[model samples]
Target: MATYSSNDFRPGLKIMFEGEPYAIESSEFVKPGKGQAFARVKMRRLLTGSRVEKTFKSTDSAEGADVVDTNLNYLYNDGEFYHFMHPESFEQFPVEEKTVSDAAKWLQDNAECIVTLWNGRPIAVQPPNFIEAEVVETDPGLKGDTAGTGGKPAKLSTGAVVKVPLFVQEGEVVKVDTRSGEYVSRVK
Candidate 1:
């Protein structure tokens, strides 16, 4: 197994800590006048999506995790698991609900998504940055309200509710930013 020293700590770096795979979220180097330099790392456990903070000396090292990210097309959810297919090989697999997590809201049939695998098992799922979904329910647009100044909550076909501009109405397709859950624009 490969090892990562403190110098290699950075956001997105995956390593094994306490027998679990963790992805580094942030790393800060602290140098005090009284003692040796150390690094403070904030990482998320890939298997359970839990966050943890650890301090390491400058010379400390950790084993690298056998993590791989693959692009897969999302099929659908069967209430118990979410199905995905490999684009090239057409091999299909089912991922647990916990592994899909919040990304489940953005999943659409045949949409591309990144699946993180640890030792050949799915650990996490990342939906695309932008998703175009139809507004299934929302207040009717008022007359002369095309200025888009105020916003109202709109429920999407995928079950995610986001604030859309005043001019938006039900049944209109709108693009949303998955990272922040913000409405981008109406799909033409």
Candidate 2:
């Protein structure tokens, strides 16, 4: 574990507070010109999926946790668990549905993901930055629906529903921004 001052903070830095791990989601250094400078941060709790805001003195330090992440490829789902294998060691892992529930809807066989491990056990899962999935159902495009403001909803191959332009039809592959869960563009 290491200590880091709030002044040196950056997004995605994992720090420990009160024995819990929190990733810095957003940080802002504010000096009101009268009082001491402080760093106001919004953090996401790693294990509990809770978000919190904390204010820290610019000179105060927080403990950095021992978190490790490894890139792994999704193998298959056995109904109850999702399997992943490391590319280097070929070791396989099974993550419970409770852990990867949200990602399962966007998951497809052989997708690559980053598994966050805390003390060698998977604590959090990160899906790909972007993925290509085929749309399964949606209303037909209107003849004059070119504004693209209020797009139609469509179910994707991975079971996630996203808004796409009316021109996007069923059975067409489209790119999705995994982080934002927004449809990017048609694949082909």
Which one wins on TM-score?
A: 1
lDDT of 2 at 98: 81
Poorly placed runs, candidate 1 (over 4 Å) = 144-149
* Tens digit of per-residue lDDT, candidate 2, span 126-173: 899899999998899979767747688999999899999888888999
Global lDDT of each model? 0.94, 0.89
> Could you give me the TM-score of model 2 versus the true structure?
0.90
Cα shift from native, residue 10, model 1 (Å)? 0.9
- Number of clashes in every candidate structure? 0, 0
Alpha-carbon RMSD, each predicted model: 1.8, 2.0
lDDT (10s digit) by residue, model 1, range 1-188 = 79989978999999999999999999999999999999999999999999999999999999999999999999989999999999999999899998899999999999999999898899999999999999999998787766655888999999999999888888899999999999999999
Clashing pairs in 1: none
Worst 10 residues of 2 by lDDT: 142-151
Give the Cα error of residue 166 in candidate 1, in Å: 0.6
